[model samples]
Target: MLLKTFGWSFAVTAAGLALAGVLWGWKGLAIVGILSILEISLSFDNAVINAGVLRKMNAFWQKIFLTVGILIAVFGMRLVFPVIIVAITAKMGPLEAVDLAINNKDKYEHLVTAAHPAIAAFGGMFLLMIFLDFIFEERDIKWLGWLERPLAKLGKLETLSIVVALLVLLVTAMTFATDVAHGGGDKTATVLLAGVAGLLTYLIVGGISGYFEDKLEEEEEEVEEAEEAERAEKAASGAQKGSQGATVVGLAGKAAFFLFLYLEVIDASFSFDGVIGAFAITNDIFEMALGLGIGAMYIRSLTVYLVRKGTLDDYVYLEHGAHYAIGALAAILLITIKYEIHEVITGLIGIVLIGASYWSSVVRNRREEAAGGEDAESKAEVTSGV
Candidate 1:
């Protein structure tokens, strides 16, 4: 199993570097390797949360996720999306932005820098939406029962996120229009226009997709019922779930793929902070790419490890721990959209949240065990009638 896991990872890493080599050869490989590791470390919580979601899925979807999701991550989000950001915000033509991103490393780096606030805003709001969605929606078990009732009434964090996003964009426009201007109307107009354009993309495209996503609830319910019935029949038949554990194998694959998607999304979110912060460290696109790519590898491997070891199941609330981390990360992203918090600070905050959640889960588990022991002893005493 270990060999199989490591082998696939090695293949993926080699492929990524070989692609990198098409541009900068051995140097590119060295750089991407370093970056991947950094991303991996900062993304520990992301992996945990992913394990939780992936565990719920079937194996076939998991394979499709790894194969299809990588394309989405590498091309859709990383390559195309950044260029799209540049085209609208930088006021460059879309194709021109893509060409520049390809050929002119320094210019492309500048676009990413200029694009940070918008990226941060998008990620922050999106993450806030995630946390809110988790809170209002029913959970399998209520860890935050105390807070759930209050948080539940807030009604769909996704909707609220869109509102917050619009507010941010408006505020940003005013900042550029009135505060940062050298009194040039056209430049301010461009900023204002770009802000509107970005806002429209979020609202019309991103927002609609998010809002309508809830409509799929019926389809999800039907799928869950069928799955539950199958599980019930299996348990009653007294078949041992051993090496032929197709169910488990299926689950593992699901969990791995979800982790893969979650990792990509987390990396995408973190990239706002990371890629923006990278400029402060080095303007050289090659160095930044190298550092970030290497970091990504580590995050991916960590995600796989969490799944392979059944960390989510073994640790119980580890998934909760990670989402809480994500919540904090989202908040940090929101703050950084305007204030520019340091990467170390953002990462440290996430570490603390996950650490605290793990501690809480341990306490909860111990308490439950103690209660169970007491109950068993009470039953024994009652049967003895002494």
Candidate 2:
């Protein structure tokens, strides 16, 4: 199962190593290895969230996520996005941007790094909304009841998350926008605008997806009612038929289209910091793309694996951990705009939060098993007594 699930990842990793060797010999191979590790370490939470969303989609959409989405992640975001940023910001043409990256590596890195304020605000705001919306919505299962329950109550007030997000963006602009190191001069306005753009992107994408999902739900409910009504007749006639009529399709058609777009945007927001952080390790655009692309293959495989194996169902709080990691990353991105925090630190925080949540889930499972055992023993004793 593992081999079948992750064959593509293995192929990609091999290709990455070969590409690195062909391009820059042994040193390039080593750099690609390091970048791949860095990318994987930073994005485990992304895999978890992707799993949660991907499972809701059908097999066809899931395949597109692995195939087409991987292309976008590797070539589009990792390679082209930075060049476009530099071209726009430096007021240079695409060819000049490419030339700058090749001829003046430091200048290329500097240009990309200089745009961090806007990137951080935008990605941070989008991710923050994702985290806030997840935690605020009421759920039968609560991972961090102490914090989540109260927040869920507050979530009863519609737009609470949007309001909070706007306030945070305002404070971020006022506080860090003036910092000479981060948001120099008029950059604060740029950051604020980017943040608003992020918010709007989330609202528009999420709103469209939500509408289709609701329609799917209503269709499923209607199908179930019809099925129940006909069950008696079918049973009396000694006929059995498989499920039919609208069948609660898993994010089919237009629903899948919009959700796919949502997934891509979310994936982009997750990768924004990773792209910026990669510059800290190496300034080579091709190297960054090769390494991160290899890691991205594995992450995509992991998402599909989790969905197929129903890992989220077994480890109930795993989703909670991923969202919390996202929340932490969002805050870190915003903080990074003002202060230069190490990528290692950012990665570690996510690992720690996810690790703690996993441990808690294990403990809870053990306790439930023990309680079930005790109850069974008591019931047996009473039965023997009778």
Candidate 3:
């Protein structure tokens, strides 16, 4: 399973490193290697969150995610997207942006950094909404029962998540975003506009996805009802009972398409920091793309691996951990608009939260097993006494 899942990632890693070495010798290879590692570490929680969404998709959509989705993530987000940002911000053509990226690395990096307030506001708010929605929703399993239970109860209030998100964005725009020390200009209006854009994007995409999901659930419930009726009829006739076939309802058509869009947008939001942060390591745009592309391939593979292995099901708190990490990343992105925060700190927060969740899951599983064993032993003793 490991090879089946990660074979392409390994291949990409080898090719990326080989290309880097051929272009810039040992130093290039080393930088590319470090960038790849950094991207992977920073986006591990992204893989977890992606898996949670991907598992709901069917085989065809999953294939599209691995193939076409990787292209968008690699070229679109890693390469083209930054150029577009620079082009728009610098008031230049796309070709000019490309030239600046290749010939004048320092200028390109500076332009990108200068645009950080708008970028951070958009991406940060989008991610913040994701975290808020997840926390607000009621679920049968709560990892942090004390906190989550109360939040879920409060979730009954309509638009609570959006209200809180708007408040945060407003405060940040008025305070942190207005500081000129970070980027030499007041970006209050820029932050407000971009943040609202991000918020609206989330609402539109999430609303569409939710509608399709509801339709899918209704279809599945009807199918189950029909199956139950068939069983009842068979029992009435005293026919020989046979095993019923399993029913699988996979998202398709418009539902699958919008879900795909949602997943890509989520990837974009996650990549915002990684893309900006890579400039610190190397101002070479192509080198950053190659290294980050390789890392993205591995993340896609890891997402599929988790889905295929049912890892999220086994470690029930894993999704909660990922969302919590996302919340932390969102906050970090907003904070970095005023003050720089190291990528290591961002990565470690995710690792620690996910590690704690995994450990807690293990403990929960062991307790459940012990209780089951005790109950079985008691049953056996009672039967013997009878």
Candidate 4:
């Protein structure tokens, strides 16, 4: 599997270069390779987390995640989200804004940098959730029985990430609430607005859309149960096949559509900070796209590798690790929202947390094994009456 992945990685990297060559000859290819590596390195945790989610989906949805899902990451999030960010924050026309970004790279970069703090705040809160969840949750072992009910009930505090974001937001709101007074003007206000938009998007679509989707899913399941009960006798015959076919088809379509839908949103969430971070390295859209696009391929491959290797199932704590990474990244992104921290720092923090989780998981596995061995020995002695 490793060899296969390496082969594909090479194929993708080479293909990306070739595509770059077509676009702008040797310079583009050089930029493409460098950016791809940068993106892949920066997004390691994302790939691990995506694998965990992608594995939960059916094969069809997994394919959708790879194919269409890549498009969303590469083009939708990387290229377009920046423009959307500019559009919301800037006074210029949309095309004119992009043109400004292209022409006046430094000025547009200032806009991207200005937008980073709120982005960091959101990602930081998210990453903090994942981290706390990792430490407290009974994912691999149930060592902390006392904390379980409370953490489970209250859904964990995630105090650090949230507190930081609120502070940042408060400062931002007060400092930049009215554009006329503050030199920063409406730019800060626009960022806060964008943060609300992100929260609302997550709330409305993830919260509301998810609610209706769940309702429809339940109803569909009920109908299927009823159908199964009615068709049980005739299930062996061709007559029932004609009747049951519609039910099966409907369920399959619904599942596929939702699987695709969720992946898209998840990809968007994962890409949010990374896209913002890309501008930090270079504002040239070509480099940003190629680098981020290459990074997107790695994310795809990681998802596939996880699905193929059943790594999530094997590691047990990996999903927890990824979520922790996401929580941290979310927090870091939120920081970018108000402050001017480097993207590399944010990415590194996420990577370190994930690495720590994996290390912890290893130590945890050893301890559990030792405990089990001791228990088995005690049981053996008891059986022997010794």
Top model number, lDDT: 3
CA lDDT, candidate 3, residue 46: 96
- Arrange candidates, best lDDT first: 3, 2, 4, 1
Q: lDDT by residue for model 1 over 61-179, one digit each (tens)?
A: 54544556545644555456667877887788988986887688678777776665556556765565556556666566656667866666565454664465457555655554343
Task: Please identify model 4 stretches exceeding 4 Å from their true place.
Answer: 2-8, 18-30, 101-103, 114-149, 156-188, 208-249, 367-386
**Could you tell me how far off, in angstroms, the CA of residue 209 lies in candidate 1 after the best superposition?**
8.7
lDDT of 2 by residue, 294-357 (tens): 9888988999999999988888888999999999999988887788888888889889888888
Instruction: Give every collision pair in model 2.
Output: none
Between candidates 3 and 4, the one scoring higher on TM-score is: 3
Model 4 vs. true fold: TM: 0.75
Q: How would the candidate models be sorted by TM-score, starting from the highest?
A: 2, 3, 4, 1
In terms of lDDT, model 1 sits at 0.60
Give the C-alpha miss distance for residue 97 in model 4, angstroms.
3.7
The sequence of per-residue lDDT tens digits that candidate 4 reaches over residues 205-270 is 444534545655675687678678667755456565566666655665565566566556656666
lDDT of each: 0.60, 0.88, 0.90, 0.64
TM-score on alpha carbons, each prediction: 0.67, 0.94, 0.94, 0.75
Candidate 4 CA-lDDT value: 0.64
